[model samples]
Target chain A: MALIGILGGMGPLATVDFMEQIIRLTGAARDQEHLPMLVANLPHTPDRSAAIIDGGADPLPALLEGIDLLNRNGVGVIAVPCNSAHHWYAQMRAHSAAPLLHIGEVCAAAIAPQVTRAAVLATRGALSAGFYQAALVARGIEPVLPDREPQECVSACIAAVKADRPGAAATHLSDVLDALSAQRIDAAVLGCTELPIAARELARPAFALVDSTLELARETVRYALARGWNRPV
Target chain B: MALIGILGGMGPLATVDFMEQIIRLTGAARDQEHLPMLVANLPHTPDRSAAIIDGGADPLPALLEGIDLLNRNGVGVIAVPCNSAHHWYAQMRAHSAAPLLHIGEVCAAAIAPQVTRAAVLATRGALSAGFYQAALVARGIEPVLPDREPQECVSACIAAVKADRPGAAATHLSDVLDALSAQRIDAAVLGCTELPIAARELARPAFALVDSTLELARETVRYALARGWNRPV
Candidate 1:
């Protein structure tokens, strides 16, 4: 299988979450059977949401530097776990020599046939950026979002997760999902990578859940397995 | 802070655990304020325990390759999470340009001043190889081991964790720790990196517990912080 490059540390916890998911999804009995990965957990990279939606400093140069490091270390495929960062996906893909996997597209595909209308719980930046909603629309699925009041609640929950306060985030995230359920949404997409950290407490909510991190992990394993199959027998 | 290199995927979950600990230990409020890390989660590297204590294929060459990759990517210090792998620490340290963090030494020091007689729960390879035990002994701490029956139980628990069966591993690990408590051991060292996954379930046993992975993470953070202080301010 090809070496996987992870462009991570958007909030730190989410990066570890993504790596753990990738490890769990792989069907390896021993260490030598699992895929090789190079991870640049550069927590020093400027915030993606702040840069794209808040008119904050651009994170592209740091992203490019991470990609360059991954490339130098021999990663063949790159994946960014941050949903808000998809706003810069095109630019990152253009600058990267390795193929960049789209977390939003993968999540959209997984939820497309399962639900007609889905709500997304994400950073305010991801909500404003529209990559997730755009991907869902492309798949013929309607995306639902919370009202302004509940949207702020969603943002607070995301912030709590980023700050490593899973207990507080769980309560706020539950409220955001409850608000979406009141709108008759069919499923909920966990667009922010950090949201999955509260997944156990979420209890599947009142609707089906589409976890972007899990989808990305499954996509990564599929990519690695395909490469392994194509290699000389 | 300096770029920390992690030579990981000795068991993929342990790598994630170590990374999570590092993230938690660092004092950062934002993404850009955390430490920078380059990790080679090369699960494809041959089994360290199988190579060292079992007279199986050597893992040194693969270990060297990972270190070389980290070096090329500009890592300032290297840390390996696997306890059994420390049998090769001297050789790995010799082959790399970056200073290697000895997980056993770090754990031993943290445990030495706290307990006189500490039991170790680890892989059969680590128990036989003696690096962790030797480190503890060197610091004037007496090391205790479970009899063959409970020792095999400890090995089974480690294997279960590596295989991703946390529920089963937790049950077995609890049993092993119970046996040590019955022997009146003062403390316990989680010598294998994977053992910490069941740590919460063990409830600190009848004595204090030293997590080698947590120690390594603390050491990694100290290394990065020290480097930051030394840089031109």
Candidate 2:
């Protein structure tokens, strides 16, 4: 099995969820069978929106440092659980010697086959920054964004997730989904990992909801298995 | 107030724990009053111990990329919650424009007046890498490490933490505490954040335990307040 290195703490809950996904997906019989791992959970990062919109702080340097830590440790591959951080994925990939598994690309690839046009429900910063839009467009998929009011609500939902308020976060996500439905979008991508927790609750039979996080987890498992990190039982 | 940027996901659980600490420690009512946060949880970091001890892969470039992400976003301060990643603190600090908060320094600062000679109970990688020793020495304090066999046990405990075996992990910490008692040490430092969760269960009235994570939390709160991020109660 290959050693796994994790750069996390974008929001503590999301990070834990990602780890749990890895464990569940790997289905290791014993603790030793689980992949050897290294984690750098730095929670002192400034607000992503504030950094981008208000000139507050950037989280890229700490992220690169974490990648370097993992690279120095000789990890065969690496994965980051944060969505917004993908904004700097190009620069990060340029610096890393080992292959970096892209959460956005993985997620995009997963839902691409299911929908032709999808609306993104994420933070305003995510939309304004063109993080996921560019990715979707590159895949020949039409990207729809939440309107201003809904965008603000999406930001609030992300904030609620950071504050550990799952209920309030879910409410915010529902509001965004409503807006997406009003726009006649085919499906909605939970661009923010936090959004999925709420997205699941708001999911309906008519609406196709895509969770980027879950997709990333599945992709990671496929990557690890394909690379011989785990032999198929 | 200066924005705090986090580069995390050393392990998802630890990252969430750190974020909880930040939220709990901060005295804020509204979301905006709380310090703005930017986080990039990259779980794809290469294994630190494997790379360092077994000649696996390098983690430096990934870490630097994280830092650069935060830097480009304009984060004034950066912090990484993973104790092992501090091994390259000097290098990361030198490379980034933002000052990276030192978890070891924060730990040392918190415990300096409380204990004179502190025993370190941590992962083999952390102990072998001299992360705590270097921090303690800089502060004029003596660090006591566990003996060989127990140290191996401590490493096993850390591995348990990575494996998400809380009970086994705690038992390993308890065993290490017993060894510290045999040495008649004044106090034991939960050098690894995972160790504290375990240490708390085994703590006795006579034994003093210093938790680097809790100390970092307190320090982070102070930093936020000092910078006027928190609204006055």
Candidate 3:
């Protein structure tokens, strides 16, 4: 079996959250039965939102460095858990040794069987780039994107999660979901990884939630288990 | 600030749990404010207890391989969140480029300020090695060691956490804690990294609970914040 690589830490906490989902979703019965992952948690990568929203420094060099380390270690599958980082998916794959798993494609696939229209909750960069929106459209689903005001709320909710303020994050995130529910959207695509922390308490919401992180994890697991990295020999 | 290295994934969940603590403790106000961590989440590490208890395969080679990878990456501080892995602390440090933060020593420091006697809860490998016990003793604190029965409960709790069964893990861990409290112990040292997950809901407990994972994370935060990794430059 090949090594699994996670080029993560867009925000340190979100990366760990993604890892937890991978562990839970793997359903391993023991320690060794779980996947072998090498995580390049490079939090110093220039902020993806800042880079895209403003004319800030490119995160490409740092992202490539992480990929190089994973590639050097002979990672069979390389996965980037951050949704916003997918803006550079093409460029990242161009310099990679292994195939990169697309979060937007995975989330679109998860949302298709359940919902007709989905709300996109992500960073302004990811929203403007339309990576998730394009993927959803490609799957024959209507993308219910937030307007300017709601996009500001989405940004705040993401920042709150990064600051470890769960209360304010959840409150603001719930408001965004409620507003989208009023639009007759059947699902909300949490296109930003940090947003999932805030939406964690949404038990039976007004609409279904397609967590990009979870879907990406599910895809990673499916890709891995099929390759027989599920357990030791 | 130097890049932080975490050689983790003894049980993948335990490593993620520790990373969450670090992020929360860092008090970062933004994504870039968090620490830059490179985690080698190698879940395929040979069972530490099996090696020490039943003479199974030596985990040192794999342990050294992880350390070498971190060394090559130019990390300033290396931390191993697993208590059982500390059995090879000296040897690992001998091969490591960066100084390894000793989890037992950090836990002993956390326990020394408040308690006279501390209960030791860890894996069979860590228990038999007496790393945490010796650290407490060196700090002029008496170690309230669990008897055979409670140790069995501790083992079961660790196994349950690895198996992703919270109910069984929590119940067995509570039993271990209750037995320690009956012995008039001042505090219980969660000498195992996985034990903290089981004890998460023990609010206002019967005795003081010194979590080894949190203490190690706290020490890591202090070490990091001093070097000005608390926020972006």
Kindly report which residue stretches of model 3 are placed more than 4 angstroms away from their true locations once superposed. Answer: B230-233
Candidate 2 residue A229 Cα shift, in angstroms, is 13
**Lowest lDDT block of 10, candidate 1 chain B:** B224-233
Colliding pairs, model 1: none
- Each model: TM-score of chain B? 0.95, 0.89, 0.96
TM-score of chain A of 2: 0.90
* lDDT of the structure predicted as candidate 1: 0.83
Best by lDDT: 3
Q: Write the per-residue lDDT of candidate 2 for residues A157-220, one digit (tens) a residue.
A: 8878767777888898777777767676677788877777666566572568778778887777
Tell me the tens digit of each residue's lDDT in model 3 across A18-80.
899889999998988898888888888888977888978899998998999889887888889
lDDT of 2 by residue, B73-121 (tens): 5566787877877778888999989878888878877774656688887
**TM-score of every candidate:** 0.95, 0.55, 0.97
- Report the CA-based lDDT of candidate 2 relative to the real structure: 0.70
> What is the TM-score (0 to 1) of candidate 1?
0.95
Q: Which portions of model 2 show Cα errors greater than 4 Å?
A: A1-233, B112-114, B200-205, B230-233
* DockQ per model, Cα: 0.64, 0.05, 0.78
For model 1, state the Cα shift of residue B211 in Å.
0.8
**TM-score between candidate 3 and the true structure:** 0.97
* Per-residue C-alpha lDDT of model 3 across residues B1-233, encoded as one tens digit per residue: 57789999898999999999998898888877788888888888899988987898889998998999888887889999899999999999999879899999998887747687888888888888988888888887888778999999999999999999999999999888778777877888889889999888555467888888999999998898888865555
lDDT of 3 at B190: 88
